[model samples]
Target: MKILVLLGALALAGCASKPVPPDWQADAKGALDGFTDDYLKGNTAAAEAEFRQARLATTATGRADHVAQVELVRCAAQAASLVFEDCPGYATLAADATATQRAYADYLAGRWQGLDPELLPEQHRPVLAGGPIGAVADPLARLVAAGAAFKAGRITPEGIAQAVETASNQGWRRPLLTWLGIQAQRADAAGDAAAATQIRRRIALAAGQR
Candidate 1:
């Protein structure tokens, strides 16, 4: 699906790899957490090394899925500079993100909208991973609260809209674009053609397409 192509960049970034065997997952989250802590303290060098070690530990399992997850952290460390914004270790991260967003938007143009957030699987949520380099954003509690609201059937688009705005404000570029594309699809599905068109256009602009 177009959504998968758009998200592949981030998914492959390493947080949500395949559900590995229990033994592998036991250390996966901790590896990420340790890296998170180290990066938050501005000890990126140490974090990188720590992450590399964690990734290596996955080798014993020979679980491609778990290894991919660990490698995501390793990738972050590779791209990470002493500065936080630097990551994915490859110079093409931004261009790749831009291209992916463009492809998603183009795919959505003229498609039926009416999308429901509830229909999106957990793995498909448009949230970015990684803590800030010298700062932390353990918004996990908040995320859980939001998710609970959905489970309680008390969630509102307004709340998601606010979160989307916040993500944009925080400069989480790829997630912001992905969220916008989803909103556009929902608007189309809601029969708000005008809004949908506008959203598609915005998505295009964000993707540097039109």
Candidate 2:
């Protein structure tokens, strides 16, 4: 009876909220809410402090450390917006990214590691609602490819630039734009100026009057 009850509890927990797809509005909203809730209740300072601690939990010297830094980015963005228009300075973006990355890592709980990529669902609705961002038939595929390339050091600056250019010429939207910009920045920082320039130009074009 106890075994059956335990299984039932696990089943109920699974039914409550499934793993959300990347760039899903619902998932993003959940993250936003987590930060906003912390930002409210006079806990902004505490949230920021938590990010700092998460940073210390990284590998001593490796990409994983950089990955951890990415989580801290979330906290910084939340802290700024919680104050309405009084957004924090541009300098806070780094911290915001680090915090965000850390938060994602926590949410992911190491599930992607060694898991069969094919087993994961192709697409999922965000925890929040938004129209389908694209018709790629496999949005998760892009994220997984990008992540694999990142882990393998194959996503160089030039590669990112090329991808951004391609995406731009093809008239991609939403999450694609976001991904291009992010990948370009990472590649540029890793020494791919061409990729960064291409991404920036596309972004400027998207904004109009660039």
Candidate 3:
């Protein structure tokens, strides 16, 4: 996943519990709503604008924590948008972020950085552990970790396959579709006939559903 210019919902960075000013909350919430609405509607250009609006919200009446949180949201949007092949890492954002908020950045960094387990701190393990998929608290997050694991050379294709299956079972269609499309292309390039066929079929089914 490229720098998540997040094209989807789920405010990963807001997981932090910074004391937001009451006055600033309205603008922040508005920007978030606009960005998410535009993104889901496939208006990426507009989505980018809305996210920028979010950034602007931090410029006025925001603390350092608020600024970091806004950047985190922007980064996630960039990553999910797939506008670029490489998304920017949270770097200090992860380091300085609230414990709750940092995991999202850490995991995203882990994916972009190629399965570096160090990116995911020890405290984050519970969420990253489990069966076919990682923890089931959020199937999307689990799938992300599984993909990162494959890239880092920690898991075989079988491991990812199981996670993918579980994601589908959980009805995570959009993210699953997006993932399948990428995997299909990779399998095709690698001449993995079995994987390519399976991924393609899944993609086709997913497309039809949409």
Candidate 4:
């Protein structure tokens, strides 16, 4: 009697819980990874196509938060590559974003005031605390920190060097060339003509112009 009734209710509740569709999950993850890989390798057209597929898969979930998260992934990759454009996609969904997502968005945009470090990924947490960028273990995380620090006008020559090294080590040509160009400009500004010329050669080599 009572046991049977309770069992029926429990079964009904379980049936009502919708599981995530496997296809959506696979499509989203695969496309996002493809986009990141292509973008980092400087394949702009392929990255754009992959990102479109990712967005479509995420949008199928009918969850604004999920869509916003995909946008954040794109923004983070762009940040790591030193492209500091406004994260317009995330901005559109911001009102529906979770507190942590909003905080991450702000962090990517270099808006540090009132930012909650705990809301950020562990690798990015130290950046908010003014800790050394070299302390971040992951190469991509280090590049991300360097981009943020550059946005905040807080990046030093050492920080730029670390970012250049990280990108070069990873064979991330896009960011490597960008960082090398910046290093060259810094050297030129300081009247280090020899150093600037050397950096320019590295940039040319990285750009496949050599």
Candidate 5:
């Protein structure tokens, strides 16, 4: 009986280890390619539909979703006009100049988010952290700490607003801008009209002409 039980478990494990279905990758890639084509043609709805279908196909149990691929294609299509002035291939993707430029800016912002700000080398940690707070000096880590503070209402909106301004001035983008917006909303809820107005102005100014 024990031997039979062991054999059953082994068989189950073997079945579970089966390789991913070959069709999934090919189907996902094709769908992603279709999304890009539709986007390039300015068919936003059709591109979005293709991307959604591709996401579903890529979500198979044993396969990784092709989220990055789909997102890149969509970004390339939708924000083509906003590519930052510094992008390498900006000249070639000028068909939808405005959307491409925006896509590049978003791409850079997304790339910044992926970096583990806290884990940066020591010299860079203080800059990212916004100050020297021992452990939370890494700017991203400080942002997480700020969130917890906000949730607990332990830190005042005024304080968070200051941090956001400092971080934004440091050339950090989304994280700083996001926190500033949060602080503004929080101030509004607390009826601190002065603080809320100031934060809103800061956000608008930070957004610049872009």
Candidate 6:
């Protein structure tokens, strides 16, 4: 995922005065990267374990912002998979979070009121301006935009199609299944039985069913 920037920021924050332990930085990055990969591939158990390890590494810094960055990274991955949660972990550290971090948290939560789009990721900036989400070239960025659009009740059929295509192309099984399921629901709701059936077949394939 595109979380290296946030990780770098966390590392910089930790090294503002004294140098952060190299082991802690390595452990946090490795665990966080593992968590993102495992979560995207649907390895829930491994993802959870890695997430815990990442959090532990960050917590060792004794800085709430470091932990908050970890939580934000987790939430961003979940968002890409179309999983919507309260992000209570981030809320707990909101007070200690940077303005940029708070803006991102609000962006992920669909609270666009008074939000500064400039603070958001470049791929997401256009989304806040009512631009087409399909225009975002990055696969993960496209999915993030789709999830945010869905939360904002502004997701278009084209956005959903692009997200499905992106997930399928990337072999992201977890999100492929979720987006396919959503497509099936939309087709069913619109009385397109044939389309819904086709989507369900794709869902079964993604889920490793015959």
Runs with alpha carbons beyond 4 Å of true place in candidate 2: 1-110, 114-118, 122-170, 190-195
TM-score of every candidate relative to the true structure: 0.35, 0.29, 0.55, 0.88, 0.32, 0.91
Model 1: CA > 4 A from native: 1-154
The best candidate in terms of lDDT: 6
| lDDT of every model, 2 decimals | 0.42, 0.37, 0.53, 0.80, 0.46, 0.84
Residue-level lDDT of model 4, residues 1-210, one tens digit each, is 011110111121234377644677667777777887788889999999998998998798889887888888888789888898798998899999888888878887888888889988777888788888888887767877888888777888888999999899989999999999999999989999999999999988999998
Better of 1 and 2 by TM-score: 1
Clashing pairs in 6: none
Q: Which residue runs does candidate 5 get wrong by more than 4 Å?
A: 1-135, 148-159
Off by over 4 Å in 6: 10-21
Model 1 residue 138 CA deviation (Å) reads 6.8
Candidate 2 — worst ten consecutive residues by lDDT sum? Answer: 1-10
Give the better candidate number (1 or 3) by lDDT. 3
Best by TM-score: 6
lDDT of 4 at 16: 35
* lDDT for predicted candidate 6 compared with the true structure: 0.84
| Candidate numbers, best lDDT first, in rank order | 6, 4, 3, 5, 1, 2
What is the clash count for each candidate, in the order shown? 3, 24, 14, 0, 21, 0
lDDT of 3 by residue, 57-155 (tens): 755853555656666655443433222223343454445555544555555444433334344534335434534444434433455556544443454
RMSD score of candidate 1 (Å): 15.2
lDDT of 5 by residue, 1-210 (tens): 011110111122235477654665556666666765564344568877887876666556322213343343343333222222333333333343343233333333333333354433343234233443224544433443444333323445454755575456545444456667778778898999998898788777766623
Candidate 1 per-residue lDDT, tens place, 5-99, comes to: 11232232335575544544445455565764465334668767766666666667655444544543433322211122322322233243333
RMSD of each: 15.2, 14.9, 7.0, 9.6, 18.0, 3.1
